[model samples]
Target: MPGGIEGFDRNVFINCPFDKGYEPILQAILFCLIYLGFSPRIATEANDSSTVRIDKIRTLIESSLYSIHDLSRCQAGKKGEHYRLNMPFELGFDYGCKQFFTDQRCDKKFLILEEKAYRYQAALSDIAGCDIKQHAADYQKAVRAVRNWLVSEADIVADGAAKILGAYADFQEWYYERQLAAGFSEDDIKDYPTSELLAAMKAWVALGKPI
Candidate 1:
């Protein structure tokens, strides 16, 4: 069968910070999801300028059976800088869709993440009762939390988080060397598109995932 909302069983919408600083955690989440046989969908995958961004995000949420929202970057980093509301905004949208939509939509599952436990309560106090996971800005912890959540929600049985982390480390080394050998500049490799990165990850995992 074709994919998308009709195949929501494996589609996982990822709502998280897209800044350069959050790239490592983002990669870890994607790797964990792909490794466990889940399809990761993000707003960035769509590049049509004609459609409004909120509409696109809503479409993704409605089509996904599961979602992961990272609110770790909600706070501003420097003085006078405004805190980011996009992550929380998109999260609320997803929640609202699940709450007010049809039965399938209502069945949607969520995993909300923060940098530190209880820190989200300060800005988004309404989510106080939800089970919020803290990654503490550590990729290993993020991978563990993601893998555990998927195991609980998706009923997936996969390698332990520690093993996945080791695999990720090995992949990084292999990917870097391969890119350099292919004559890709450091900047080119670093700025590679998300779609290409994901394809490379899928290919790597399919090729026996050399360590």
Candidate 2:
């Protein structure tokens, strides 16, 4: 949506929580998508407090041919915490878009991710018939799930998860050095934004995904 439909066929809408706890898996997903030559679209790519958030997200979903929905953080972790609905909410919108907009989005595909086995069945029983993949809070498993999904649904020939993980580690080191050389402090690196990190991953892949 940000760049129009130029890369719509290779664009992937990422629906997940934006929090410190989910950062690792989030990075893994971003790196995997960029490494495999796909564009990863997430709400954080822009920081416009003035813009209506759901409208921005719907624009992204409509522009993407594929999506990855993570329902891992839907359940509240503590007794007083309210469960999250944004992830599942966007996922439903994407599904409905594909089903209702037959002419424009009939071919859209999505992958559902959970952190635990059969967890969605208890809270989101309507999706019981859909196949969901669990990551168990492991970045490597997340990479594998994303890689396999892209391969199967998008017909992409890609590197295996382990190899991609190794390359991801290499990119982190490369990016850290580059940022420091450009005068970014260690603290700055630690606070790197996901939107910026996605750009760095694309640059790393462009440079041949050096290891």
Candidate 3:
């Protein structure tokens, strides 16, 4: 007899005491079989030099910017709106009243400009809910529109100053003081006026704080 499991009588093994050590041995055998069964293998003959170059070229194409993002489903978030990549680009030209007219004498001019910006923001927020699959085109269009605005009309100087020079401190101080006077707790004005909140944001940014 081989002095191992086989050495034991067949009938005796059937009624043998349970060994916790046997469990680990059985588990290891199963693990080995499963790992070997699924081991990956290269198919067929090795690739020639030309085939290797072609494979590299295919990989480059797959990684290009034009191939990276699925433009058909590309979407961008702007202000509060979501835009689909497939949508037609439409510039909100009507929203730039402040830039179009230099006249500050008109009382309604500033109001209209403010309203326009707010409306644009609201419009963008509405887009944020657009389904990416169904409105992919629309999202792309909106993204382009937003990009144009950010590139052409953004008040880069004032915005940078507000963000880097604490120029918006007056707005925040006034807002904070007003909230205090109104008996509102700090938390109460958490979502206060957009202008006031953004002003504070600019001050924070100016202080080199992470947004």
Candidate 4:
């Protein structure tokens, strides 16, 4: 579970549901992390068809010094549908790594997010003592939660959440226009891979995040 020190400090493992319902929050988290100068890592980033998902997740957790686990969607949305355990399970794994691992791994930091502020304690009481932030499905709140967390935990100076949100809007508008100019339809832009979008984010950040 040991990762190279080079990326260990900057990499952040993001644990959240990948359903379409959560896309905006996911993108917000990514944008916030990148905007604050962290490398966001998630299981889906592993594109090797043969790679086991859990294995990839473990590698990401072990390699990352920081992690964000959103347990907002852990409950079943409807009757007869099973609740999702993967989010909490991964959170547990990451927590165990921090508590049991040695040296720099002990310095690992975590940010737990839930859709509603107090809902997680009702179902996941074991982690009741942990400070969990609430977003209530608001992408702006998600951005603020992540921005504040990064500034506090990473000990890095950053513009406020409003600045990041404003830049996110700028990035989206620029990306949208650029994709349209590239001959992609509105629908096609939504279908673009996250890797491409993230690369563009990096490029945009490098270019000073022009409006």
Candidate 5:
């Protein structure tokens, strides 16, 4: 089935137990439950608050990544069933997020970047009636808070953290492009810190810059 909510309906038809005669009734109930279980809320409380929206989006992206990592571990297990479930679960998460935005691509090496871009776009759209400069400043401040935490406790950040850090740098670059496209002047976004920038970007995307 395709990853979007609509595709889920078609998928159930394909999994139909109706042809089996007696089991169709039971299967129908089961499918209904399954559908409800997997569906994400169409509108969240954060939708009204840009900051909350940005936080939720970043949480989704990180959750997706963590899910992927867990699936990888499952695939590496000696048990065959564990490995079998890994592929389907991983693919489902990938498709769900990919289908969330029309402009974002969802392949490896690009999923994180795509998520960031969609988030930024979402943030800007939500806060359009508000003060954009103040929003941007609040966003930057939140980012610096996260950066300060990471920098002060660098040793515990773990290995290969560079790769994660590099992804943020890429996100910043994409954010710059997005802001430019939105007609935000050069002076607006120039002073934001890059290293601790992911939190800021996430704030912008999820929470919609502070009040």
Candidate 6:
């Protein structure tokens, strides 16, 4: 099987925009995943141009028992700008993998997120009936959406969403101070590699942040 890796059940494949504009929501989602004791995996975790990018993504999909796909960037942001399709394309691939792979793969779960409810229908009409959680461009809302979904789908017993959001807020302040103390400028911290950011989050959670 393609998903023979250890800890596959706790792996979560996150598919979202990597732009600066989406950082806050992305970070919130990441924090929620880690706080709930799930490992979040993304395409940026590795840089192997020698291997086909789609193959890497397919491997990630096969290895993750759950996935969260944010299609908020499906529409163009500015005049004449091209719409982004990568998010939905990967979502389709993940769904296909679960459907056509072994029986264990069919147990895979997914959560689809958007900036506004029903907005995705305008562009991706094929997924019209699927439940799409709306974050409305609010990072806290995104955290809550992820928290509630995990609780319901993964059978996780988590603190209230407000409490988790509060912990994230505290972590943000601490992360900034610590990063600055380490001689990283604001831009440097903001643009830090995603792997490093994930490690920092894991370290912070290891300190027993009341999540």
Error of 2 at 10 (Å): 0.4
Candidate lDDT values, in order: 0.88, 0.90, 0.27, 0.89, 0.31, 0.89
Worst 10 residues of 3 by lDDT: 8-17
Cα lDDT tens digits, model 6, 1-211, are: 3436867889999999989889989988888899889999899877667988888898888899899999999999899999899999999999998899776788899999999889899889999889999999999999988899889988989999998888888888888889999999988987888888788889999987633
Please write out the lDDT profile of model 3 over residues 142-184, one tens digit for every residue. Answer: 2233222223332222232223223234444655676789898
For model 2, give the 10-residue run with minimal summed lDDT.
1-10
**lDDT by residue for model 2 over 1-211, one digit each (tens)?**
3245778899999999888889999999999999898999999998899989999999899999999999998898999999899998999999998888756477899999999998887778999988999999998999999999999999989989999999989998999999999999999998998778988998888888776
Model 1: residues >4 Å from true position, as ranges?
A: 1-6
Candidate 2 is scored at a TM of 0.95
Evaluation by lDDT, superior candidate among 5 and 6: 6
Per-model clash counts, in order, read: 0, 0, 16, 0, 12, 0
lDDT comparing candidate 5 with the true structure: 0.31
What lDDT score is found at residue 138 in candidate 4? 93
lDDT for model 3 comes to 0.27
Residue-level error in angstroms, candidate 2, position 91: 0.9
What tens-digit string does per-residue lDDT give for candidate 4 at 10-76?
A: 9999999999999999998898888888999987764788988888888888889999999988888
Q: Scored by Cα lDDT, where does model 6 land?
A: 0.89
Model 3 CA deviation exceeding 4 Å by range: 1-165, 194-211
TM-score of each: 0.93, 0.95, 0.22, 0.95, 0.21, 0.94
Which 10-residue window in model 5 sums to the lowest lDDT?
Answer: 9-18
